[model samples]
Each structure stands twice: as C-alpha cells, then as structure tokens.
Target: MSDPIAARPAQDRAGIRVICNDHSGRNSREAEAIDLAMKVLGPQAELCHVKGSDITETARAAVRDGYATVVAAGGDGTIMAVASALNGTDCTLGMLPLGTFNFFARGYDIPEDPEGAARVIAAGHAQTIDLGAVNGRLFLNNASIGVYPAILKERETVYRRWGRRRIAAHWSVLKTFWRFRRPLKVEIEVEGQRRRFRTPLVFAARSAFQLEHFGLQGADCIRDGGFSVFVTPDVGRLGLLSDALRLAVKQMRLGEDFELICADRLVIHTKRKRQLVACDGEKFLMDGPLEFTMVRDAFRIFTPPPGDEAAA
Candidate 1:
C-alpha cells in the first residue's frame, strides 16, 4: 500500500558493524541498491567479503573481530549458512536477501532491494527469532523429506543459476513433480503420537506457506514459544490440482490436501538411502528418523524501522 517509513532516528540505533557474503547470485538491480547501502553506512559499517569455500570462516572471523551485527546478504541457503555460524552468539543478524523465493525475507518484510533493507539495518533494532533443527543442523524455515525434498533439489539448482524467472521455475517444478522417483513413505511422531503415511511426498514445516501462499498459518504467532507445522499428502494429479487451487486462492485452512499441527518437537523416519531433506531452502542428504525442534528466541536479528530492539 503506502510506502513504509524507511529509517529511524540515529540516536536510538545500537550502532553498526556488518559482515557480508558478496558471493550470492543476485540481479543487478539488487546489487546496485546494496552497493549504495554500503556507501550510505560509511564509517558506521565494516563489511567482510567471503572467500572461496570460506563463508563460515569469514563470518566467524567477522564476529571474532567484534562485529555486533552479522548480515546474510544472499538466498535462504546463505542465510542459513550465516545463521548457523552466528547461532548461540551475541552478534545479531541482518538479512540482505537476494534469493529467488526469499521465503523468510517476504514473511518478515525484509525488502528485496538492498538499500531498503539496509535502511532497516541502520535503524539498529534487534529481535530474537526461533530456529528449527534436524539431526544437528540449523534451519531458519521448514524441513521436508521424500518428494518435497526432491522437487526442492531441482528447484534449487535452477534457481541458483537463473534466479526467479517464475515461468522457468514452474516449468522445472512441473518436469520433476510428475516423475519424481520412488514415492516417499514416511512414519512421523509428533508430540508422542505416531502415524504412518504412504504418499508420493511428505513435508514437515516449521512455518511455511499454509496453502501455496495464502501465507504461513501462524505467521504472526510463531517465535512466541510455539511453532506451526504442516504435512502434504502426495503429488499425484489430484494432489497437483489441490496445490494449484491453493496457489490460486490461498485458502489456507486445514483441508483434505493438508495436515496442520503445532508442537515443540517432531520425529520422522523414511526408507530411502539418502532421504533428501530441506531446511530453509538448503537441501542435503540424510538418513532415516530425524528430530526437529523449535528453539525459542534462539538468536537475535535486526528488523526494520519499527525497531526490533527490546522495549526498555
């Protein structure tokens, strides 16, 4: 609607120290905007550019070098990388999103434009955000195994190279959704209840599109000591049709195609050798029976001019 207030008064800010991942693939528009942001911050900012295979190392170095704010300037993958690196540390996170979907970015109103996001960072308000983990890895968003992970793997490869060409991303999704190899049969236990589901796919979300983008079911309520979860049945034509409808209308209530739940922890098992799984948008191979938990106020992150700083 109306243009959001871009920045807050400088006197209230907690000061600035930024660490950046310049390696992320981004459109030129976003790049130029972020460059301007860096220039605007001037002496208030100290940026660390990533070197080969050293995203974590450089980020940790920034923290060790006394950076009070750590910014993840790339996709969800980059965000997760930085998030995990800074997890449990005092440095607050700031995101300069440059990913295709930017699921978390959109959910939190983190602007896609670097300058817009930077203005928020300059405001210097910080809040603690929850994170979910599978096995021992940390993820800022949802996680899934089975067909969902497979589709995500394909989506990731194309997205990394091409960015968000909606038609192309959809086409790639279509090519894989129909012919996904080996249906995913999963057994999951949540809050001490167990269920066996034999479906073409499975998704365990810690806050995801409730119905394709009507929005996350508990968007406003998450990080308040509880987390929302969802599971998709399968990926056949009917399933595809249902997903399509969800995309079209965003009717996000619990319906036949979806199962919504809330809990502190969950466990899942699969019969696949390397059950493909995604946490946030990062995908990796994992073995059966995993636990996912919500860590309340896990880490502090910077938000916009509304000022995420705790009220004194």
Candidate 2:
C-alpha cells in the first residue's frame, strides 16, 4: 500500500500560526531562534508565545482561526501538546525544535539549527505521520510506565533545586534508582497473545528516529505502522543499571534485558486502577488497563523534502 504520509506539494506560507513555548530550553539561542523564525516567516505569520498549559488551546484556536499551518516551536512535549490538538486535522504542523533534545523534530529530519528549521517552514512542504495513543492520549515520540516516569519526576525536582545541567540529570537517575525498587507486574496482550511480565519498564514507541537515537535496530517496525513495545525484564538494580549503561553506549542487544514486540494494538493490565504514564515527556495518572493503539498517518507535519540535507 502506498504510504498515506507521502509528501505533498508546498503550501502557501502566508497564513501560518506558530505556537511557541516560553520555557523550552535554558539556552538563549532558542529565544533568538524564535525571533529569527518570526523574521523568516514574515509579517503574515502569527507568532504566539505561550506557557506549557496554553499550548493545546492556542493551537486549537489557530485551527479554528483557519491557519494553513500551525507550527510548534518547542521540544517534544511542546510539539506533542500542539499535535494532540492538531491530530486528524487538515492543518499542517511545523516544528522549530527549540529544545535540549528534539527527538520528534530531528527524527523527522527537521534541522536542529533554528534558522535552518525556519527556512524549511518557509518552504512549506508537508507530510502525514503516525502517532501513538495510550488510553486515547496522543504521543508523538513514545509512552512508558515504570521507572522512566519516576526518573522524570526526580529529574524535574533535581533540575529545580540545582538548576538544569547534565550532572543534575545523572544525580536524578541515581536518586530514582536508589529510591524505586518495586517492579510492576503487568499482563500485556498483543496480537492475540497473552503474556505476563514482572518488569521495571514498558515502552511503546511510535518514532523510528527514537529507536535509531537509542541505537536500537528496529526502525522498520515503526515504518510498518505499529508500536514497538519494549519491556524490561525483572532485573535487579545492578542488572538494570548495567542494561541502562549498555543502552547508553548502544550495545544493549534486543531479547536480552529487553523484549521487543511490534503490534498494532496492545492491552496493558495492572492491579491498580490508576497508574502514572509518561507520554512524550508529559506525565499522566491514567486508569488501567491501558489501551495502546497506533494511529497511522494521524499528523500532517511540515518538513523539507526527502534527500534535501542542505535545507536541514
């Protein structure tokens, strides 16, 4: 079947609305990039600087106001927020990638440099892309339960206390690992097969770029329009730490510490009625059993043409 997300011809750049998050990254360059983007997009484009909470409503308002393209100028979380509002809509989504790690933007081949990304937006080519949903909440990158969310919580606390830095992130990791020792007992149903696992993490990935970013060899699964479910086995602290190190170094073999399952849909059941889930860096306490589904070609995203590295 022909991919529904195949590239479309460039659209008019006159009616573009950019929804920017004020708190994306610590670097002054992001602010400069936003300014540069506004200049590149010209007077016709509408730029709205918003707090994290207002992203969705602002994007939706843009759509209601009939914008040809609604640009998300922030990180994965910011993009995902705007995406949740724009998914299944006809409006094209543009990305500025003004974050520490722009997994979605970079994965889609959007340039890391703000000026370069702005140029791509001005050019105005768009392609449809898939999104993953957990309990009906959309995610552009991936969703996870277990140690990941704990780590994120700690990372936020540490970031606030010590200011954001690489060492703070590492310290958060150590703190989370030391404090969280309980593994989740989950019953996962996929492809008509039922299996139970005692594990520390369950990851549902929608972006091939994220898989490749982690040096995992399964981008094809994402391209096939399914969730690549990664489950960490019931490894102890030392084992978990070792596997994490291997993953960091890109040497963690699949089927060893982690089991990968590709599925169009999955059911993850746990004893608790509500559990914390991390979706593209946002935290939610959602009710289980969590139903995960792949929404193929759910988002129409602006990008430079394929093979156009110079634009990137």
| Full-model lDDT, candidate 1 | 0.65
- Model 1, position 243: C-alpha lDDT score: 70
- Per-candidate TM equals 0.81, 0.92
Worst 10 residues of 2 by lDDT: 1-10
Tell me the tens digit of each residue's lDDT in model 1 across 6-94.
12222333435554556565556766766887875667676666742576666666566556677877777778887777776767788
Per-residue lDDT of 42-100 in model 2, one digit per residue for the tens?
88788899999999989888766667788898889999998888776667888888765
lDDT of 1 at 248: 48
lDDT of each: 0.65, 0.83
Model 2: lDDT to the true structure:
0.83
Q: Model 1 clash pairs?
A: none
Which candidate achieves the best lDDT against the true structure? Answer: 2
